[model samples]
Each structure stands twice: as structure tokens, then as C-alpha cells.
Target: MPVSTVSIPVGQWFTDDSGRWWFDSGSLALDFAYTGAIRVTVAPETLHAPDDLTGWMRERFPMPVGVARSRDLFDAVSLRDAIGRLALAAGRGEELRAADIDLVNLYAATPDIPPTLGGGSRQAGRSVQTVGQALSTIARDAVDCFGPANDGRVRICAGGCGIVYLDTSRAASRRWCSMQRCGNRAKVRAHRARKSGKVALTAA
Candidate 1:
């Protein structure tokens, strides 16, 4: 059976320590082709432009691929460090936390969701070795080298696709920076899934 499509807003992203836009990862449709593919035919950059958030709500969008890492492409320490401290705390190794390590952002370009190839259940996901030291370590090192606060937050400003970290403290209650979209979406998905059997795995 084919899975139905569910489209949402695109989120913003940040430039890693190396200064490359890792662009938001959650809502980005990696497979968004006109033929109805999970991966989108359009370029990721089309919806996302690093630090260039001139778009607006539902207008251009600023959502992540899914609700997972939002920027799982960080393959370096500097870039990892660039991820907010809360992100680092949540991220496993230099990547997203154990919960979202294997999840690929599944949000779509349109208002539809494509079939997830591997399915959304990440119960089997295993922890992977990080690049160099942990993100926290790298962040600390950078702070020391820079001799000041470079500010652990990245700037991603896509009106609707953006997330503003309300609190980046050490608490575990830090879900999405905003509750209107990401957080609300999660709640809705869980409810819908519980009410129906069609939902196998959801990254909304």
C-alpha cells in the first residue's frame, strides 16, 4: 500500500561552525518529486536559504524536515558546536540525540506526505560514533579559543519555518522551540495514530 502525503511549512536552519548552512532538516522533503516520492525533486536550497530568512508564514515557510534533529548534516565539531547548546545536549555524539539519530526529515513541500521507505519506527536505531569529541566539548573549546560567547545559537529566519528557543537550559522539557507548530504537530500525530492503525511511524 502507498502512504498518503502530508505537507507542512518549511523551517529555518543554521550555518555550522564551518559557516555552511546545514539548513533545517525536519520539514525538508528529501524526496519531493512530482511523481510522489519521499524525496523531493526540488533542491533543498530552494525552500531553505541559510540565514536569509526573508520569508513569511505559509508564504515561504521555515519548517524543518521533521521534528527530529532539524540539522542532522552537521558532520564536524565546529558545525556541531554551532548547533545550540540545548541541541548539543539533546543531540547524540555530534549529531541529534539518540531518539532522532536515524529519523530522516519527512515533511513535504506541498500539504501532502510521501511514503516513508524504511518506515518511521526508529526503535532499532543504534548510536553512532561522533566526529571527533562530543558537541559540548567542541563548544567549550570554541568558547575558550574565542575568549567569549560566540552565542551558541544559529540564526535561521524563515517566518513559518523558524524556531525560537524559548529556553536553552539543561532541562529535558525542551521539546520544540515553538509549541504552535512542531510541538502541536507532534501532539496531533500521536492522537491521530492512536485513533487509527494506518499510522505506522510519524515524524510530523
Candidate 2:
């Protein structure tokens, strides 16, 4: 049976140290894309509304799923918390304690539901292993980021968005998550400050 498509709402995504598709926003305490698909919890007042979890999962991963269960959601939140801390530590060039690594690895090693042949048009069914796959992928990426080959590319955005990304720029000088987003906003603010200074000088 074809899974019904729900109206997947638009969400803001930012790359974190753990993965390239991490959801992020200044408005959201945590990315709804991650929280909704993984069923994680954020502040109650956060703007992340996970009304259409099925559609949300489809938009990101190929795993078939209905609404996420509460237990899975809790687990996702826990794993995400560890990922956030590890990413932050990497961004700051700080050491990661063994406990932090262990937490991430524990989630990463979650056994995936074996894919089985589905009747008719369904090639293989994910059952409910989507969450496991997602968590493991995050763990693998985190491991890579800590490796020497990619560690130098890790950077925390200076724009205060609290986002982390691998700087793939040729100059390795990429700062904010995007030149059009946080970077441009910072430039505009600086310009306004210069203008304000000039006006004050004239008045003086």
C-alpha cells in the first residue's frame, strides 16, 4: 500500500558537526525537522510543531514511517543532546570526554530493523528502523569530524545562530552558515553602525 502523503511543512536546516542535514534556527530551540522526524522534545514553547511526522520523514529520509512513538522520540532527543554537545566541543577545539563519546556510540550502535521484501510494489520495508538509521548516521559523521582528515573544516558560526558546519570553502575562511543568511545580516548591521557613527560625528 502506498503511504499517504501529508503536507510537510517548511523547516530551516543547518549543518552541524555531526551531519550535513541537521535542523537549526534562531527561532527554534531545536530543529523541527530533526525533532519531528526523530520525535525529539524541545522547549514546550518552541516553534516546532510535529503535526505531520509521516510527511516530515518522507521529505528527509526514504524510510517508511507513521507518527513516531513517544519512546522513540525520547531516545532521539537523548541522542541529539549528546550530538549537540560533541559538536559544540569540536567547534571550540576542546577535548571530548570518554563519557560523551560513549553516549554517542551507544546510540549509533542501535540495531537497525532488517529490511524485508514487501508484497507487490514495495521493494523493501524499513519497518521502524528509520530512527536507528538516523542515529547511526549521525554517530558515524561525528566520528569522521573528530578524525584528522575533517577536523580542520569544523567551525562554529560567529553569527550567534549556534550552528556548526564544515568549511568547504577554498580559502577555508567561511564563517557563518551562509553568506546570504547570517553573513549578510551581519554585514548590514555593520553598515548601519558606520552610518550611525558618521551621523553622530556630524551632530557633534
Candidate 3:
């Protein structure tokens, strides 16, 4: 079954140690991947408890999902790690691991929230009622993103943020995850470097 590609809004934010909030990856699966520590070494695990998972789902999905249990948290973290690994491989044009593929397939095979019609208004109907369904939806999106349909559009953030995002730009030249975050930082660093070089030339 072909999963319809869904565009997740760019509202989900993560705060780094410097207290700066960073935008999430554009896709649902990639956003879910952002919940875990991708490449940074310190403070890796973000989904610490069941409530954490519940909070994450509530923030992303339009409707409220049931409270996640311990088992749900465990499974969610496992799926998140698998998606991160597979996404990195897809972005780098490397062969994906069999275990990661099988795990994502297992979750994708589960039932997911379906779009529904109500009150004569068409809603995306992401009314996720359970943790399992939410995970399934994410896994299905991952399959769409990393599968042959992707055409190698996935890319890791060049700014060293370790975010794996689908390159949706027209030119496919996007390097940073968010312009306000990494892009702005890069610009500031370049400016400072130029200023320092000018100072050195004056001293010489």
C-alpha cells in the first residue's frame, strides 16, 4: 500500500543547551527522529518516560492520543532509532541495514490513523487514538521517504546539526536544517572571521 506523503508543519521545536530552539525536520518520521539524540554526544535520550512520549505526540498530532504506557515508550524509542539510522543511510546513499528495514516494516504493517470526513469539512484526519497507530503512521511515512519513491532526496544537515531532512527545495541545494538556526549561525561566523582578518591586516 502506498502511503500518501504528508507535510508536517515546521512548528515542533527542540531547545539546545544554549537555550535556543531549533525547528524540527519537515517530515513526520524525521520529526520523530529529532526527538532522539542523532549525533551529538551529550544528553542523548529525550523520550525519557511515557509522559514524554505522550507530550510529543500531542504536540504534533491535531487530536489527542491516549496516554502512552511504558511499553509504548520503549517501542516508540526503538522505532525512532531505527528510522534515524535508515534515514541517515538513505541520505548518504548507503545500503540500509536489514534489521532497521525489518523493524520499520514491522511498525508500518500495523494499522494507522486514516483520514475521515465530518461536518462537510475535509480534515487530514490524523486523529491518532493510540500510540500504536501513531507509531504506524510515522513508520509508513518513513517507508515513503526512504523507499525507491524518494529518489535520494534525503539529506543530513550540513551545519553539523545531525538533522536528516527531505530536500524539498527546488534546486536541492539546501545545506542547513533551518536558516534561522544553522544558516544564521554560519553567516555570523563568516562575518566575524572577515572582521578578524581585517584587524590582522591593519596590525600588519
- In order, candidate lDDTs are 0.29, 0.52, 0.78
Query: Model 3 off-target regions past 4 Å?
Result: 1-11, 41-43, 120-128, 191-204
lDDT of 3 at 194: 100
Q: lDDT tens digits, residues 128-187, model 3?
A: 479898898889888887887566678877778666788767777788778887788899
TM-score of each: 0.23, 0.59, 0.80
Give the best candidate by lDDT.
3
Which is superior by TM-score, 1 or 2?
Answer: 2
- Where does model 2 exceed 4 Å of error? 1-56, 111-128, 190-204
Residues 116-189, candidate 1, lDDT per residue (tens digit)? 33445762213232212122222332232222232333222222233323222344244553454446667888
Task: Assess candidate 2 and give its lDDT.
Answer: 0.52
Error of model 1, residue 198, in angstroms: 12
Error of 3 at 42 (Å): 8.7
Q: Give the TM-score of candidate 3.
A: 0.80
Per-residue C-alpha lDDT of model 2 across residues 1-204, encoded as one tens digit per residue: 101121122335544442344233311112332342222232122213333333444555555655555555565566556656665676778987678778767755665334355574755663554655544544554555455765566667788765665565677788885666678789999999999999999999
Superposed Cα deviation of residue 82, candidate 1 (Å): 6.5
Q: In model 1, what lDDT does residue 34 have?
A: 9
